[model samples]
Target: MAHQGFPRGLRILTAGEYRHVFDNASFKVHGKGLLALACPNTLGHARVGLVFSKKNVRRAVDRNRLKRLTRESIRLGQHRLPAVDIVVLSKRGAGELDNDTVQRQLHGMWRRLEQEAKRHLAATQSIA
Candidate 1:
């Protein structure tokens, strides 16, 4: 089957949606590394957001590159996530890092997200 990325049915596209993710969810993935958090979207498919702060990286080119890497990581990992919207923010260190570094960090976070979603799915299945 072809890979479906960020399907229309699963996008959370509003400021309110982003704020809700930040406000209600607790971070799930933290390590000698990156952190991951997921807030199930009332909206349909999963979305992603990357925040690269200029204060940390200083170069617009670097910031955008980091964002691109983050997106690719999510695209590769999309199937593992729940049918919810998502936003992946880039920390200050993001811009300073290379694309490979950002990609590794993001995929690591996505792995945790996948595991958590699996657990949630199992709980739902058992309850139903």
Candidate 2:
């Protein structure tokens, strides 16, 4: 079986790395209570960053739950995702969502991001 761990390499560890995606995001995927901004990368795999603000989540426990869910969702779906740096931002209502609802929304967003990435790849390839 293929290893499906959320390794350090798959995480946006540094502030500089997160800033790179924030500044150069070319694709935006929005869901009910989440927003994912992504930019193409040359790393040949996808990476993710989470920004669950204290004001938005209101509790450390809630924030941690959201982050865990987000990481798990990304880990399972990473194979289908393109090589991009994705930063996921939680909105005010995100903490209220149930696990199932959050997972569904995340899956939908991933699909949208995949489509956008494919279109972008094709467009860029055609121009080159």
Candidate 3:
């Protein structure tokens, strides 16, 4: 069976890596309580970064929960995504949502991101 884990390879692990995506985001997918910035990459697979600040989430428990949900959402949907670096940021109201609500919003965001990435890839290919 294929390994089903959030391995290091799928994570954006450094300040510089996160900065690169923040500085050069090609597109954004916005959902209730969350916003995702994405830029195409050459890595042949998707990588994810997350930003859940204390200012937004207010509690460590809530922050952790958001991270878990985001990671799982990415893990399950990564194969359908194009090669891009994505950073998911939390908004002030995210911490108040129930798990089911958060998951539903996350799933929708992933679907939107995937569609956006496909269009970006197609456009770049045509331009090349």
Candidate 4:
């Protein structure tokens, strides 16, 4: 089946909530962006929070813009992903890219994320 974008039910907020998903992270590379993931199980569905830290990119506006881009991209391509508490952090120049460019990069990241989720689901099923 084809992947659909992230749904409203999969959004994470608050400092405490952020820590919940950021506790443990996995590092992956896809296209021009870096995909960071944290798989903390939630009550019903997954909540995702994308972080573009100021320390990594510098400037508040840039950080916010990149975060917005990452969130939208995830929302636009969350179908293939399983229930995951994910966080996608931007590297250098992520803020410099245009919306179209960011979209393309995010699409590629989603592909990797889909594969990762499949692996995770398989492992989980084995455990159960």
**TM-score against truth, every candidate:** 0.73, 0.94, 0.92, 0.70
In candidate 1, list every pair of residues with a backbone clash.
9-44, 9-45, 10-44, 10-45, 47-86, 49-87, 49-88, 51-90
Candidate 2 lDDT tens digits, 1-128: 98867899899999999999999999999999899999999999899999999888898988999999999998775549899999999998899999999999999999999999999999989999
Clashing pairs in 2: none
Order candidates by TM-score, high to low. Answer: 2, 3, 1, 4
Top TM-score hit: 2
lDDT of 4 by residue, 2-46 (tens): 776666577776778667666755435455645566664655455
> Where does model 3 exceed 4 Å of error?
1-4
RMSD values, in order shown: 3.7, 1.8, 1.9, 4.7
Candidate 4 regions off by >4 Å? Answer: 1-9, 26-33
Model 1 residue 7 distance off true place after TM-score fit, in angstroms: 7.0
Candidate 1, residues 1-128, lDDT tens digits: the string is 98846554444567887787778664356522244556766444566654456676678898777666666666665546665556665555655666666667777767777778778778879999
Model 1: CA > 4 A from native: 1-12, 31-34, 42-44, 76-79, 124-128
Q: Evaluate all candidate structures by whole-model CA lDDT and list the values in order.
A: 0.63, 0.93, 0.90, 0.68
* lDDT score at residue 124, model 1, on the 0-100 scale: 74
What is the overall TM-score of model 1 with all chains considered together? 0.73
Residue pairs in collision within model 4: 4-79, 5-76, 6-75
